[model samples]
Target: MTDGNPDSDGLVVAAFGNRGRLETAEGETLPYLLKGRRLKAVCGDRVQWKQPPQSHEALITDILSRENALQRFDPKGRVEIIAANLTQLMVVLAPTPEPDLFLADRFLCAATLMDCNPVVVCNKTDLQHNDALRAALDEYRQLGYVVVQTCAEPGGNVADLTSLLTGHTSMLVGQSGVGKSSLINALVGDAAAAVGALSDASAEGKHTTSATIMHRLADGTRLIDSPGVREFVPNISASSEVQLGFPEIVALADRCRFANCQHLREPDCAVKQATADGDLSPRRYASYKRMKNITASGSV
Candidate 1:
């Protein structure tokens, strides 16, 4: 499988463990196996593959360069890449299972750092909007993130959601109970993603998206559905990178007394002053501080 001659340029459409499905330039979809442990592939990755004379699967020989990748640290403090070559990061959240604002902040930060558009979609609008959810969405909107309230199951205002997804490689990411799969099913006009119901006791939606896979809309837009997670922290190399992830912080950073203000315990810190003056959401500032601490510690 690792030998020469049978070569093709392909795009990774699905990723599961060590193997993935690659679509060739000629439009042939084939199962591809990795050439070695060093070559890891994810959805939207451009790759080169070769097939041995009598091999059943194509061997992924090389992974092409990526424009950008969404990444975070695993529990063991190892780097975990969510996806590659994404133009949008769709952070889905809802009223139930308790929307984690901090988690949403992390995803938005990652998007800003990656130079990708971050969208906040509040699904399950059939459920009454809790105060916390409303506050979170309002804050995000105030911060200039597009926030849409959608009812994926009953197909309410789905057209508005669809309009934003067109012409971009968008990824649906959030905790398990946020109706991401439901939104996918509604958008793609099919039951491609498995939708799970909330448990009676736990009030949490079971994880249905088991793998990271890419699907295309009729208009040629690409969408990736990622597995639900309880906690997420973006992978940042340095403390300076943390402020770059927050738009408000970056906007006010120049007004700080020190050029290298970490925004924590520094004199005349505009960010801290903004939080104190109610110009910045305290919750987001707290999120920034916590993330700064995580990056400063050099561990999760």
Candidate 2:
């Protein structure tokens, strides 16, 4: 059989070399080699490659354009691109399993810094619910983000969540045991990821030992299942940009007494006043203070 034109483009990624590779859009993961001279590739990178008929292998030639990329600092302090061309980030949190506010804030800030729409997903709602949590989440909904509540075990609200992901490439980020894998199974209707039960000792879900991978949902959209994260340090482009990430803070910054108020121990700070008057979410303001301290440390 004649080979397809090598110029016909394909998505190129680096995977465990021993794992079966991906060559085409058929959803079958296949193995391929980086034929070019020492080029590093990441997930969601588009490239042109050709599969050799003689063997079950392929070769990558070039990387195409990237609309936007999500990156973070690695342990070596190098910026690593986690995903490319993501239109949205589905930040998952489960209340029945217990709430993890720090993890949620980290994911939200990272998504905002990376310029992707951050949507909140509260899973396992059937087990437990809190009015305060709902009201706090509404703050995000009012900011124009789509928020959805889901119960993964009984398939509650999974269909509505699926509809929101249709036709967009999204990344799922949250802490371990947030029903991320369970929700993935519910949405895709397949056990693509192993499901673990919550721990008896700490009421936290066990981690699934698997590599991060991307899968296309039946709705014609791509979803990347990233490994759950425990910590996220914000990489603000500028010290001033930190205010921009906090919606309420940005609104109140202009009214501060000083043009460059840090909002901590500063006289006549509008943000501090707003926090006192209940205009800003106390928890959100606390998170902002923690982040501001981190930024002030010059560690970023």
Best by TM-score: 1
**Model 1 clash pairs?**
none
| Model 2 residue 286 lDDT score | 85
In terms of lDDT, model 2 sits at 0.69
TM-score computed on alpha carbons, candidate 1: 0.90
Give the alpha carbon lDDT tens digit for every residue of 252-290 in model 2.
899999999878789999999988998877888887777
In model 1, how large is the Cα lDDT of residue 90?
93
Residue 11 lDDT (model 1): 86
**Consecutive 10-residue window with the lowest summed lDDT within model 1:** 193-202
lDDT string for model 1 (1-300, tens) is 334355689889887777878877876678889888998998889998877568878888899999999888888888888789999999999888798888888888889888899999998888898888898888889888999888888646677678898899999999986888778878887535323321122435434667777777887798888778888878887878988878899999999999999899999999999999999989889999888887766454
Give all candidates' CA lDDT scores: 0.83, 0.69
How many clashes (backbone N, Cα, C below 3 Å) per candidate?
0, 4
